[model samples]
Structures are given as structure tokens and as C-alpha cells.
Target chain A: MTDPLPTGATIGILGGGQLGRMLSVAAARLGLRTHIYEPGANPPAADVAHAVTTADYTDTDALRAFAQSVDLVTYEFENIPTAALDTVEAIVPIHPNRRALGTSQDRLTEKTFLQELGLTVAPFADVTDAAALEAAIAQIGTPAILKTRRFGYDGKGQARLTSPDDAASALDSLAGAPAVLEGFVSFTAEISVIAARNPQGDIACYDPGENVHRDGILHTTTVPANIPARLRTDAVLLAARILNALDYVGVMGVELFVTPQGLIVNEIAPRVHNSGHWTQNGCTVDQFEQHIRAIAGWPLGDGSRHTDITMENLIGDDMDRVPDLAKDPKCALHLYGKADTKPGRKMGHVNRVTG
Target chain B: MTDPLPTGATIGILGGGQLGRMLSVAAARLGLRTHIYEPGANPPAADVAHAVTTADYTDTDALRAFAQSVDLVTYEFENIPTAALDTVEAIVPIHPNRRALGTSQDRLTEKTFLQELGLTVAPFADVTDAAALEAAIAQIGTPAILKTRRFGYDGKGQARLTSPDDAASALDSLAGAPAVLEGFVSFTAEISVIAARNPQGDIACYDPGENVHRDGILHTTTVPANIPARLRTDAVLLAARILNALDYVGVMGVELFVTPQGLIVNEIAPRVHNSGHWTQNGCTVDQFEQHIRAIAGWPLGDGSRHTDITMENLIGDDMDRVPDLAKDPKCALHLYGKADTKPGRKMGHVNRVTG
Candidate 1:
């Protein structure tokens, strides 16, 4: 028989942003080692990881060596190239699987897959070129968004269409890239359900967090998200259905629009999500550790919330206010030590637990 | 003006155990780096620290290089040899100062210092030999204790004298080392006050925790300790007094015996303590992070506890119960990745919080 994995086995991560940074911290806490693999230059997750590899993602030789050394592979972001994914998966298990990656990487397929499950999704159509863009706009109507099917996050590579006349210019904005057009849903608020699926087919989901956004960057997420109990159950059920369909084996973030009629699927992220940051101070176990446990085949931790929590993101210059905010006995401030305070960068967050 | 130290400055730590391991995790959270300087081989702290210097504490070359490279020095244990301490302090700023170290290193001096501060301490006298022990026991009376002057923890260097007949044997058991005789104070319970003081003279203290010990090793600490409000105030004030007298900087643990009359000071430790581990899951700021902020000259964090907490130490064979303990919704299990779980080793701890 192959060697049984040890409890302190090393886990290799392929992206080194805030997600990876938090993941590395969680891995260390659980008596496991983490090796971060990031492409070139930025400090990213190296500050806290046990080891780091700063080679290009496309370097086949380095990729092979990395896969050979680690017992398992997981990534923070889903934009990993297909070739790099194959190289690593050949030697070790990659959680979320190739099928989930292919579906989430392309918007057209993700929406179609959700529709097949009889789950609610915004009306959408694939747009291959300018001619197709106009036809899709006619079918989905005005007041919509046109987003590139792959490599988009935090509102990047997407443009809103308020009028039919702007369809041609919007297509050019994406530079003739494969895109999807979807009619906008007039929802009252946005909420996210963070769920984790273990390799043993057990699933656990945290309470949905009602989120607020500013300039497409997350501003705050508060638990007991001002939604009806029915809505909350539906959100969790929808997430479970998606994870089961994809055979997901880690934490997946499902964003939903709470409309007057019901909840509609926005998209799915096959990794940890920012909306669950409140768990750092509010729950028995935060999402990061839960993800690591699920991927490692360890038993899942309790995801129960101990108190009502409010989490606010520290964007850009807001980090300077840390000293003033830390004095409040109710707030737990966490600042990501990014070297620069450029505009729109997520510096850190603060969690306030109300008894 | 002297240049301000950068955020990622190296901090040299003198011991490499669970305390140092926890401190290293805290330092990483602040974007700072830690280099542990320990005399033993394969220390637990080496698993997570940025660097480790494994050599005899008396190795001048190793100590010199460690001191030169680090910006400031702190220690996990109070028993560093005087010569070794002098070499390191000559190069970098050692926080909690040498005065604190000298007082804490010996029982006789520590008691004398407490008595001078008008704090209640068990009556004690110096014992140089068996004859002095007999005379000291006559003054302090039976049911007293005889202990070595330095390098004792977990009941390792002390013997209890239940009767006059036990005094001679107890003194002989210590191998004629320098010792102190102490009278036993009638105590109802044991408690600990954890506090931090910065170079700027700012002090923050957490509420006292009621502790239970078995075989002289801490077994559990419960927050919102069953003590009167006035007792907590006195504990805090006593800690602050010791800190100001020593001109201390960094976290300090002041252990006390809660008598029906009032709280009596027993001993003080100049480092993060096991009793305060509940803060990891129950408070806005943990004791480990508070220690780092104090040493880094950063503003202190909030020290409020929202939920009632219970922290249990997982000693030696207790590690085998992790699988069952991890499944508890209220338990936040933390296991240090030590390779061997020999008897008396601090394998890990678990923090359970309840509203």
C-alpha cells in the first residue's frame, strides 16, 4: 500500500494573495506545514508560510518538483492555467477537481450548469463577437452586464450596459474576448454562503453573511444577515447541491442575489471567500482552517457561531486608523502588512463580536 | 535622531518551547520576524520561526552573532544564565529589563521585593545549610516549604515540609543547594493576572483567571474567575506595580493565591502565560499578540473578553484524545507539531468558549 499521509504533512498552495496568507496561518495552527507557490516578486503569503517558491507558474520543471515534494495541492484562486493544473494533478490530488475548475473558469458554462440543476439564475447568453453581442443584448434586454468568461475577479473585466446603444463599445472594452451577457436582477441585497465538503462526502456550511460593496470591493459582512429563515435555508441548500454536483472537496463560496421573488445564483468560487472573514472572531473555527481540514481528509471542525459579529474591511489608507480603532474593547482589528497602501487594495479587516 | 526600526525587524528569543512557539506565530501576524536562540536540539519553536540558533547558552560566538543581527531581545523563560544575558544585552535592547530578570530568577529576592511593595507574600527566610534550614523552619513554623534559589518550575526544585521531622530530609533532598524557607499561607483558590506594559508606559491587563493545577503543572484556567470584584482590581494593581517597579516591557504573568482576607502575590513570570491561553478564543486580543505589540513599540490591542472561556492544557498522553476533542463544538483545539509526546511535555491546549 502507498504510504499513509502523516498529520504534519506539507500542503502546497499555488497562489499567495490574502487567501493564501490566511490559509498558511491556519495550516500552521493545525500542526500541518504549508509551502506557498507564487509567481514572481510580491510579498504575498511568504511572510507567514513555512516555505515559499517564487518561480513562474508555467515553469514545468519547478512545477514537477513542487508536486513531487507536497502530499497534496490546493489553490487560492481559480485562474490557474490548464497546463499547470495537469502537471500538478498528475502527481498529487488537487481539491475542487478539474471539472469544477473548468465550470467556474467560464461563465457561460457555470450559468448553464446551474440552470440544469433547476436552480434560479439570471437570464444569460454567450457572445462570441460583435454580432453575437447585439443579438444577446436584444434577447436579455437592456440594463445588463457583459463580462469576460474567464480570468475576472473583484469587478475586473466586466462592464455594465445601461442602454442598448452601449453594447458595441462594451464588447470592444473586452477586446473581442469570449464573454457572457446576463440581465441584471434588481435585488435588495447580496449575500454569500460559504460551505466546505470533505473527501468523505460530509458537508458543512456557515451562516450566510449579508455583504455590502463599494466600488466592487467588499466593504463589510455582518452575520444573521437580515434575511428570512426560509431564505437562509435555501441558500445553504443551494450551496450543498452545487458542491455535490461538482464533487467538491473543499470550501466553496456561493454568491447569491436576494430578490423580491427569491434567491438567484450569482456565481461560485472554488476556494475560500472574503465574506467568511467574520468567523475569525465569531465562530469556533474560521473558514481557513475548515478548508485545510477538508482538503487534508481530517475531520471537519465545528462551524457554529458563538456571538453576533460585524466585520469591516480595511481598504487602502484605512489601515492608518488601526491605532485609533484598537482601543475599543469590542473591535478585533487585523491588518495585512502589505508594503504599499495603493488605492483599492484590501489592507485588512476588523471583527466586532457582540454578546 | 535615531532611525525608527522597520516593521520586519528580527527579534531574538532566548528559549524555544510552547511559549516561544506561540510568540513566533504572533510575531508573524504583525509582519515581524523571529529568530529563536535556544541551547537544546530540535526545539518545538524551530518548526515555525524564521531562524533558529541551536548552541549552548554559554557559547559566546553564537550569542554575539544572535545579538548583533536582532534589533531587540526578549526571552520565553526567566532562567537564562547571567553571563549569557550580559552578552546579548550588550548588543540589543532587552525588554522586561535585567532587574525584572534578577528578581524573578530567585525566590528569596522576589519575595523580598514583593514585601517591599507592601504586597502580601508568604513569610520566608534564606537557608544556606541544614542548620540554617532548621532555624528558619522554627521561625516560619511547620507545614512550610524549602526550595532552591533558582531554576525551578513545575515543582521540580522544591519540597514541602508537612511537619518538623520533614525539614531535615527536605533540605538534604536539595543536595545542599542555596535554598529558601517559606511559611504556608492558607489559601482558598489559585488565580493569575496577565498583563502587558510597553516602553511608552502604557499598561493593559486581562481579567484574572481561576486556575487548577495537578502535579504542579497547570491543568485548566477558567475566565470570569470566581473572585470578588475587589480582588480582580487588587490583582491588576499588583501587576501594574510590579511592572512599573521593574520598568518592564512585554507580557508578564502575576500568579496569586486568593485568600478569604484578600489576594496574595505568589510569583511573577516575564512572558506569555498558559493561564491566558483562553484569550485566543474568548477575547478581542490574545496575550501572545499583546506581548508582540508591547515589544515592537506598537499600540496595545483591546483586552476584553466577550464569552466565558475555559482553557485546558493537553499534556503528554492527552494528545491521543485530539480526535475526540476536536469534534466538540465548544472546543478550539490547538496542537503544537512536536515530533515526540514524551511525559510532561506540553503537547497542545484547547479553548472552549460559552456565552
Candidate 2:
């Protein structure tokens, strides 16, 4: 709305994880600073951000002070409490808007929204009770996943139903929360499109990267995904449609299941995604800077891939191999400075240029 | 010497300017935290460094406290006070070693050391007084430069001598400080090689970059310099020779004069050079990270150039052009985040990928 943020303006980030850490570094690259607000002490972003506020999201005083100190606000995660958004929105703008956040927070709403856009999504039915679950299973069939409609990530808060006989226990697993029954999507491969749009309606999409997950955690994302040209175009176009629909002002990650029929929307993240980390080495301007530029009202950069890169997440015990990884010229290590690396934790990532 | 610094260990930087700011960012990339020791308030490095100790370099207590907190110490500039190094060195190690620092601090000592290494150097004479200036002028010839023996950068603390008649005024301009009068060489171009070495004697050298200056301040440095392959190899070998001679344990910027006879050593910086900023975009491992890895005792990364680049400094009013520059996808901007820009001050730089 106002002029683009000046060189010294501060961008307020609402989370202090690796994404926030990378965002803080990117902001500093653009001659801007960042203030991180999080509930945890000694968050990963604390080492690099210009300022950090350690307070619960419900703390109105910290939220007000942080909003007042920054020229603009953006977040690293969706599912922020409505009250927290209310406390900050009254003070300053939050990019990717509440509509996108609200839609992505609940699985059912997200699927319905995508279907309405004339895009392919996994067949789904909302379940409110045991009877609804039975009817939905009869309609969508078995081998379906019953996911909590709100607050789920990394394989958490979900159960698998092999047959109708397992429906009651699956619903019980959700602990009385609203849920969605998504029929299994059989596909050849999975890929993600990282897209960005500015406040001015300008949009840019990075090359879709094929993804591989282990134990439901992202393991590797290789750019120039092994897909046909037609599918690549469809992936990018569908992603643009979602960005435009949300009127997004920052980067978003759109995960897709590549079926023979067409690409099906799996999920969407309203922030920079782990799968897009390859941009740090493969493009002149990476996703972090792109998000900062878009949210700061600056022109979007060219997202054309200049090199082939494979971004591999270094989880938990992978830290032990860092000395060997550091010796390789092609591997660019990006560690998050997490004090302790527990099992399944994303300690860092390595962007290895293949060519 | 003991072991490569762990993920959470801190690197204490001795200055808080743009070089230090960049080094801090690179240190964070390797999961290492940085503690910046700066005398000025609100230093450019303060916005990104993990911690900052603001006190004069002469403050022994502050220096001791800072050294005790960080695992290792490294500096951005060569002229750090001996006492400060003494205070820190008593507690922790300083990279590039004090000998390298001591040798590069004074122009006379630096030139003598290079000549002793069997390196080509400009004809020179030490001028202790006005009579010595006249004597040196008579020996080195008419066109020469009278420069302070210690603490000179960016053409500061020097006066040019066109003829014997101007000797008094040039000497008067330098006051009573010890000086050096050097005969100017008729060089075809200026090139710099950024080279690094670790404690184990492993070395890596970046390709030579040709430099251009305006008003005695560096303006641009282009990689794949317009020189024959033989000259390039000579420049790099000479740089490695210097690094090996000093038993260096970090990055060094070696400036050379390309002449008909051979390569001539102009001077050396015991830290990352401005010309090497091009590596940020053109190479997988940049000079900043190379220095951090060397000081941390990690293996040196490949310094191979992957793209052709020209780095241009944006001085003072150049900050006004950032908005337009940001629109160019090929140009990556690196700003210093100085609060105010005075004429001729280094506000930032842009690395344009030429090929």
C-alpha cells in the first residue's frame, strides 16, 4: 500500500524456526533487518535476527510492541491463533492474508477451495460423527486417511482406515475433532511448486521440484523434476491460480500428486517451503529473498533455474557426517544452529549442485 | 589447533564493518555463532551478529571478556592494536597469526617481506625525514608516491610526487610520520588473487580478478580477467607462494601489478578483500565462508569459479539507484546497512553475472 520498505526497514517474522532464520539472513542480505517473535527461548533464529521477543502469542503487549517496531509483518507458519492475528492485524499488515491462512489451517476447507478453482484434488468428505464416517467411507472407499481438519503436520494427528470396520477407532483416534476422509491417491511421483506473488498482482513460480519423504518428513527435493513438459506447465499454472485466488503477497508451497489423470493438490503452505531450498544455489534470487521482496513491495526476481540442485535435509544424526559433507565442493551446507538435534529434527540442509 | 569449532561455538570478530558483517552471515551459514567486538554504537554488523561487545579496542577487560566467551578470534582489518591482540591471544587463538598481521600493517615491512620471498616488487626507499625523501626521489626517480609507513587504505595517508620540486609539500602533507617513497610501475592492469590456507597446509586460490579504480578507490573487479592463461597462473602461484611463506591459516587478498617483466606484488591484505565479493555469486564457496572454514580448522572448500561476474561498488549517492537495480535479475545486491551515507563511503556493492 505504501512505498516499498526502505533499505533499513525491519520485517517482523512470527516464528523462530529454520525458515525464520533463513528469512532473517535474507532480509539482512537486502539491507533490511528482522525482528523474530516466538514463545520459545533460544529459538534457532535468535542467533541471526536483529531482534527477538520471547513471549507467548497470547501476550498482547509483546505482539503490539513487535508490530509497532517493524515496517511490515509476515509469518513462517500457518495455524497462528485467531486472537494472535487479531492482535497484530490491527497494528500492521500480515502477508498471505488471513483468508489463505484460515483455508490452509483446516484440511477440508483447503480441499474444497482447490476443487472450486477447477483444479484436481484428492476425493474427500467431511466427517462430523460415526454415522458420517460410515457414509463417507462407503462413498470414497477404503485405504483412505482420516486427518484432523485443524492443526496437523508431519504425519501427526492422522489415522489410516483399511476398511469400514476400522472407522470407529480411526475417528476415536482423532479425539472428537472434526476430520476429513481423503481417498488414497495413487501416483507415479510427488512434486511441489514454490510460487510467489506481490501486492501488485505480479506472480513468479520457481521450477517444480520432485520431493521424497522418509517417515513423513521431507528428505530430498530435486529441481527439474522428472516429469513431462505438459505436467510441469500444469503444475505451475495451477499454482499461479491458487496464488491469485488468495491474492497472496508472499511465497507459498503447493504440493501435488502426479497421477496419470492429472496432478492432484495434496496441501499448501503459506510460507517458504523446505522443498524450495534448492533455490539458494540454483537461482540468482532464492525463495527467502523473493518472499522478502514480495512482502516488502519490491519487484519480484527472476525464478528461472540456472543450475540443477538436489536439496537434502540433514535430519538428527546427519550432523555426524557434516565434516565429510563440508569437504565436498559441490555441497553447500546450511545449518540452523539448533543446540540439540533430537530424532527426526531438521538440523540443516545441503544444496548440492549436480552440474 | 585443537579441533574444528562445534556448531554452537562462537567466532569473535575484531571489527564491525561490512567485511565483519558478511563474515558473520557466513559463519551462521556453517552453524557457528559470531560475537562482534566493535567500538562504535550501532555497527553494521550488530544487526546480524549473535552477540556484540561495544567498547574501545584498548579496553583490556572488554577484550578479555569477549575472547573468553568465543572459541576463536579473527579480524576484518589488519591494524588492530597489538595490545588488543595480546589480550585476546592470551585467552584464545587469532587466525592468520600475529606475524601475518604484523607484516602487513606497515608498508615498508610488507614490501621487504615480499622481496625476501623472491617476489617482484616496485622500486622503493624508506623516507625517515625530508632529506631522506629527497634522497629516495633522486634514487627512485621523479614520479613517485610518498605514503605513510603504517595504516593507509583507499589512497588515504599518501601524497603523489610528480617531481623533485614538489618534495617539500608532499613531505609536509604527511607531517612527521615515517614514510615510504616508491617508484610507480607502468603496469598494463591490476589484478587480485584471493587465496586461503588451513592449519594442515592445504590451500585454495580463487581466479584472479582485474580491478579498476576511480579517485584511488576501487570501483570494479571482473572475473576471468582479460589476461593470458600464463599470467593468470603466475598470479595465483605467486599468491599461494605468499600464503605458504606466511604459514597463513585463513584467507588473504594479494594485489598484483601486471607488467611486461612479470607479476609485481603491490600489497597484501590478511583478510577477505573487496574484489573477492564477486565469489558470493560466481563460486559455490565464497571467500567469506572460506575464511571462516579456515579459521575454524575445517577443510578448505573448492574455490572454483562457476560463472563470470563483475562486482561494482555502490558508493554514497549510489544508494539512490537500488530500487532500479533491484529490478535486474542478474544483479545481486550486497548492502552494508550503514545508517547514513557520506560521499565516497561504501554503501554496498552489486555482483552482476556477466555470462
State which candidate has the highest DockQ.
2
> Residue A54, candidate 1: how far off, in angstroms?
2.0
What interface RMSD does candidate 1 have? 2.1
Top TM-score hit: 2
Q: For residues B1-355, could you state the per-residue lDDT of candidate 1 as single tens digits?
A: 1232344577888998878888887786666678899888867676567678999988999999999989889999999999999999988888778998899999989999999999999889999987898889889997998889999888888999999899778988898889999899899989999999888888999999999998889999999898888988889999999898888889999999999888889899988889999888877779998898888777777577777999999999998887777667778878777778789888889997756
Docking quality tier of candidate 1?
medium
In angstroms, give how far residue B289 of model 1 lies from its true place: 1.2
Model 1: per-residue Cα lDDT over A1-355, one tens digit each: 1232344688999998878888877887777777888896655577666677888879998899988988899999999999999999999989878888899999999999999989999999899998898899889998999999999998999989999999988998999889999898999989999999888888989999999999998899999899999999999999999999998888999999999999999999999999988988888889998898888876777577777888999898887777767667677766655777888998878887765
Task: List candidate 1 segments past 4 Å from native.
Answer: A1-6, B1-9
Which parts of model 2 are misplaced by more than 4 Å? none
Q: What TM-score would chain B receive for each of the candidates shown?
A: 0.97, 0.99
Residue-by-residue lDDT tens digits, candidate 2, A1-355: 7799888899999999999999998999889999999999999888888899999999999999999999878999886889999999999999979999999999999999999999889989999999999989999999999999999988889999988889989999999999999999999999999999999889999999999999999999998999999999999999999999988889999999999998999999999999999999998899999999999999898798878999999999999999999999999999999999899999999999997
The window of 10 residues in a row where model 1 chain B has the poorest summed lDDT is: B1-10
**Worst lDDT window (10 residues) for model 1 chain A?**
A1-10
| DockQ, all models | 0.50, 0.84
Prediction 1 global C-alpha lDDT: 0.86
